[model samples]
Target: MKQGLEPAARFAADLAAVWPEDERSGSLGLAVSGGPDSLALLLLAHAAMPGRIAVASIDHGLRPEAAGEVALVERVSGERGIPFTPITVKVAPGNVQARAREARYAALAQWARAQGLGAVATAHHADDQAETLLMRLNRGSGLAGLAGVRSRSTIEDSETILLRPLLGWRRVELAEVVAAAGITPAYDPSNANADFDRVRIRQALAEADWLDPVQLAASAANLAEGWQALSWYAELDWHEMVMRDPDAHGGLGFTYCANVPRVIAIETLLRIIGELGGHATRGEAARAWERLWAGENASLGGVLAVPSVERVEKVGVAMRVWRFRPEPPRSAGH
Candidate 1:
């Protein structure tokens, strides 16, 4: 009993580090899918905050076995006297994994709201973070993508808080917790499917002797810290060097005649594009910023960026200003 309680104690400490005690006194919704990691999360959460925690199992309805998985989680929650909610969500067509993730979060957010839960916690362990970093690195992802999954963030289109307190925990460690509890975790066949990028990456990581998932996960955390600093700097730059161009015909403009760090400029442009109701990936935003910095025109995500020659009264010369606006609609084919 002491040995089993050790992991739960560690989990409580880790969770407390991220979620303050005052705030954690409220209800926390656990997203348990009956997997080893999430089942471990359920056990740990129940032990850590017995009365304050509830369990939720999302059934994406992709596989018939999902019902069994949800039932397993519900049963475990019942045994612990934790409130359990089984949410069934429909994943839209296209990109099975991605769409399922979207559906999962959407359902969780709605459920959290309905339950009046202060936060929703998911079991995203260190190995998962390492896999995410490698996958993004393979695609030459920027700082944000390479930062991997954040420990805490807000759900999209919702005010509910999402937490991943197990980011520092290893997959094997979570599996051990479940094993010790004498629980048989539900098997998800998709975990072994090679068609999925994460499955392939996980297999490669298993075979690669030189790679350490713990170290990789640490690197990703470090990157996340660096990205946070850059984001703060970008906000500062936005306030100082950015303004709405009166002549831009309802758009934004960035004004800087002096030298600015390439990285900071890209982040600033990302902010501007986002504010203007346009979307651009980090790579796309970087390329667009580079073109605009070269005194050229560029377009990204329905937003057009054009350099304008304007007279600066203080400088007494024609300085180039970058103007961003929605791209004009094209006429019939010429």
Candidate 2:
């Protein structure tokens, strides 16, 4: 029941704030998959930024109709005079959905870099955010994972904006916008594949009557807000005890947490180790870290061995991080 162009206007405002390319002229590229969500984004960006945005349809060529749908996307892009770039991809079962998505983004990101574009926008919306939040929570991810998708980000040294203006709107609202604008988008069949966790989550959402979608969507936003605040605090205290933060060696580096308060130091050290551990999600890492600080330098991350000699140590291998306290070597005469 929202009035005409409300979402479009809001979307434009959000993109403008996120990109702000006037300060730095950019030929932004968008990943338009010929779906309602992406199509609406293309339409709004075309209307808002005029020549500043370009549309690219990644024809995964998974379905028989994919190429033709890509043609429709090309036609739409032609209507706006935004150069359409179609990159065809092979979506194989062996590659998996994640592989396909990763490939799509990699190709698009490379294209953006070549064109000297500063931002690339995708059509990830509120429902996507909700599903992602649930997935990360189900995995018992940390507070950072609860933040859901970011509004904007820099990946691979490219200062590209990831604008998700539609992230607050529902699928129904987006569908209405696309229909009212008279755009029929091709649906990706892969979205229904139950093998993928995201697709399964979507199916689950569609069937769940007890769970309120609107409330869950709001909860995602609230979780994102809370996660950001907590991350700031975690980083603030962690920096104090980070005497020698982890280097490119991909393992925990020595830290001087002695000056920090007992409770604060313990938490701060755990955060440091967690950060250094990268994707390692072992509770044992925390225990190993605590043991190191508690006067028993033990090997952590399976390789760097730390034997307490008072000062903490971090090495290329966890089994070698030893506390360096000089022990006098007996002379040959003695």
Best by TM-score: 1
Query: In model 2, where is the ten-residue run with the lowest total lDDT?
Result: 319-328
Candidate 2: tens digits of C-alpha lDDT, residues 1-334? 2435466577776676666647546777888888898888888777667888888888766678888888999999998789888888776577566668767777787788778876788888878887887788788875556678776665544455556666766777778778988888888777888988888888888788686655666677777777666556556666643555455654346544344333344345455445445222335545655676665754443334343334334422232123211223457988
Error of 1 at 164 (Å): 1.0
Give a tens-digit lDDT track for model 1, residues 116-197. 8999999998899999999999998888899999888899999989999998888999998899999999989989999989
| Count: clashes, candidate 2 | 16
Q: lDDT of candidate 2 vs native?
A: 0.67
